[model samples]
Target: MPALCWNQRRRDFYAITTDVSTEGIRFRSSSRLSPGEDLTCSIRHIGLLEARIDRAVGEEFTVSVRGGRSALTDLARQFVALSRAQDLRPEVVRVHHRIVPKQKIVQVTLDGGLGVSGHVLNISASGVALLVEQSLEIGATIQVGRKLARVMRHFTHGVGAAFLEPFEPSAVHEAMTL
Candidate 1:
């Protein structure tokens, strides 16, 4: 499963889990971490956890979870359930599923109160991909519809942005205007 791990310095890195259990988790990361280093790990759908690195060999590392056993057990179960559910569904490349909105035209507000009209290519609870004529710089803060978002990536014809505050998963729908 995909996971995000943050070092004590607050730098985040993407990781993939090789093994998981109530006691500890083993994963591979590109971030160089020493044994005994502390980390904050967030597993999708499983929430965040505090952990201490127990061992590190190349890119693989094992971390002992620091928390109540019951909480760890619950998180482990959730991970397993979600992993299984993912296997049953079609392969999903993105973190969140996107839907086309009925209203494709939207107003994108720039930082200085400048608003430009754009087309919504697709939207998810976390972010939106929009086709705009104006060139937007990556990392610029912009308002998509009514939601505040930050540009994360730029495509040939559009820009991808992550919402500053994510919407509820249930709130995303085909008929919704945002």
Candidate 2:
């Protein structure tokens, strides 16, 4: 009955449906919900409409929408028309060690014969995975991309690089491309 949008932040989709009696549309997901969790949305018909998940009612999320009634109506109409035309089948790729994306591979050349080649695996808001030929002991300093990070923990074939400074995405992406 109303338009639905995807919450990119919370990784969910939502819409305002008159089909149901609730003031906001229902978002269905299995993820644990806490109050004030962020949400984002994309409109198939109206392009992308992002918003925050305002509330959680059981397994359904209620979105806090922006824009006026006319805009909402237009977006809803487009969503309905386009939503029925698409078929989406999603697949998941799981790994034993959490993989970080958009990373680069480089050869770490220490002062001694500790030089080794490895790749940057999982990257995060705080750290990165310096996958290497050897899993260095914790607190060991290893070169990742360009900077040296201490080995926070030993993973399967790598060590989590805990930077004294944060790992910048741009630098990591550049290193990975090389």
Task: Name the candidate that leads on TM-score.
Answer: 1
- What shift in Å separates residue 138 of candidate 2 from its native position after superposition? 0.6
Predicted candidate 1 versus true structure: per-residue lDDT over 1-178, tens digit per residue:
7889997676899888888775478999887778988998898777788988889999999888887677668778887788787778566368777999999999999999999999999999999999999899999999998999999989998999999999898898999987
- Could you list the CA RMSD of all candidates, in the order they appear? 16.7, 17.3
Candidate 2: give the clashing pairs: 3-76, 5-41, 6-40, 6-41, 6-42, 7-40, 7-41, 8-40, 100-122, 104-176
List, residue by residue over 5-38, the lDDT tens digit for candidate 2. 4344544434444331225445565565655655
What does the lDDT come to for candidate 2? 0.56
Worst 10 residues of 2 by lDDT: 13-22
Each candidate: how many clashes? 0, 10
In terms of TM-score, how similar is model 2 to the real structure?
A: 0.36
